[model samples]
Target: MDCGKRHGTKYFTVSSAENFKECMETCAAIVPCHSVDYQARTKKCYLGSHHNNPLIIASSFDSAHSVGCAGACGGGGCCKDARKDDVQEPAPLPDTSCGNAGFEFAFFPNDITYLGPNDGNFNPVVMKRTQPYYKGTTTRIGVTDAHIIYGQTPQNWEFVAVNHRGYLYAHQDGEYSFTAPIADNLSLLWLGPNAYSGYTRANANLEAAYTPVDSAPLEYKATLVKGKYYPIRFSWDNSGGAGYYELKIKAPDGTTIVDGTTTVSPYLVKFGCREAYGARQYAPWGEEN
Candidate 1:
């Protein structure tokens, strides 16, 4: 009720001070009303504003509020309830045919190290002081029907043609095939014992018992460790072999750890570090190269 403050004749009447106080108390009890003030000149009481707000009280329980205030104050169940409404679960995986989603291995950039014999790898080797070789390129050597026995043995035999009394001789053979593919932009040297080395008479025979072939797609398994690098090793199967077998690998990231290749079958091309990736695609039996 507005008791016209501009008019001197305007008046407000109450039964008693207690009654007036009760009315003032009731208005004061309202949330935004602070207190009752009695005007000195007009003798009229005015209700003032207050600090009470209910909306702020409601927001105190929100998840965003809890997250924002982290350790400041222990928030109430508002955060928990909000979380219940906002929470979600991950989606199901896709149906895959090839084992491990057509992935047989993960060849990380730095997980390949190729070592070799005589022509050495990773370090220099002193072969008889006069014949010193550091490391050779990715070249392959093979032979066919040199009469070799295929089985598990401490030392498997590899074929190489040799010169006998006056004719050409062969050693360590079965129908052997080697595949050594050349990497683009990378220099590789294919060394062979010029057929003349096998037979006393040289007749423009332009082949070696050990000839090179295209290499297979290298496969590896790796895990990322501390320094944004992957620690890994090569993994493959070599069930049947006449003598010796080897594996060669290359990293896509310009870091070549393998100098020449390994002569050991089912070779473990172990290495130290590599970079990280979100998803990896590995080689599979009939996979498109």
Candidate 2:
């Protein structure tokens, strides 16, 4: 089940805390607590037994109040009694077979030290020098699809890095444009038969000093072959704030090969760290790059 910040049926106050995670942890510890309301301003936490309580109305519109439901209500029986009156069902997901293609994504938590100020410069030299601390594949499905990966609370600070690798298929041999939304840090590299090098290649390296609002889409032009799988890698770093990123491609045939709504198959390969200079360790895929 998904937990969201919204109004629900009222219940007794179990505890009061300043942190939202602490309140959610408290609710998880309780056997009867199914939901929790955390007020960011006053640091107050309210526990609820029912998932969908129609009685609790929205008192005020403020970011302080955050209500979350536990994942244990997956069976749809946690609050069945409270949802019998005029409940609207969610719309079904659209068919994703329009231009389906698969891609792999690996998430490294707090491992991208190159994104820090200490690194200063972002280049292939810097990228090859950095080593990942904690390496793990993201089990989240539809990672390649057009959707935002919600940010998580970091241990030391708020940050996340993702490495995306996949084979881009081209219908005809021509110029293909690849683009992705600007983030705190974004880097893309494509290696194919027609090799292009230096800073003029079909690649991009956007640094931390650039803001997303004032930035334009990172564009790269490449000539690909038909029905060929090219080796492509995209790395993203989010230091803090919202954790989200997007990638899109415009094919030579004037068709959107990888649109903002495209979904790709993702898998988790392994977990652990790799040495910086020992071998070329590429994120979760190891030395396969």
Top of the candidates by lDDT? 2
Give the alpha carbon lDDT tens digit for every residue of 194-278 in model 1: 2112211222111111122354422332221211212121111111223222223333333222323323212111111111111
Most accurate candidate by TM-score: 2
**Candidate 1, residue 192: CA error in Å?**
38
Query: How high a TM-score does candidate 1 get?
Result: 0.17
Candidate 1 overall lDDT versus native: 0.22
Q: Give the alpha carbon lDDT tens digit for every residue of 1-289 in model 2.
A: 2222334455667467655566666777777776666555566777777655323222221111223443433454232223344343321221123322344554555444444542333333233334444343332322221124423333433355555554454456688876665444444445442211222123443222323544676666778654344545556555555444555666687766654354432211121111210112233343331
TM-score of each: 0.17, 0.42
Compared with the true structure, model 2 gives a TM-score of 0.42
In model 2, residue pairs whose N, Cα or C atoms come closer than 3 Å (at least 3 residues apart or on different chains), thus clashing, are none
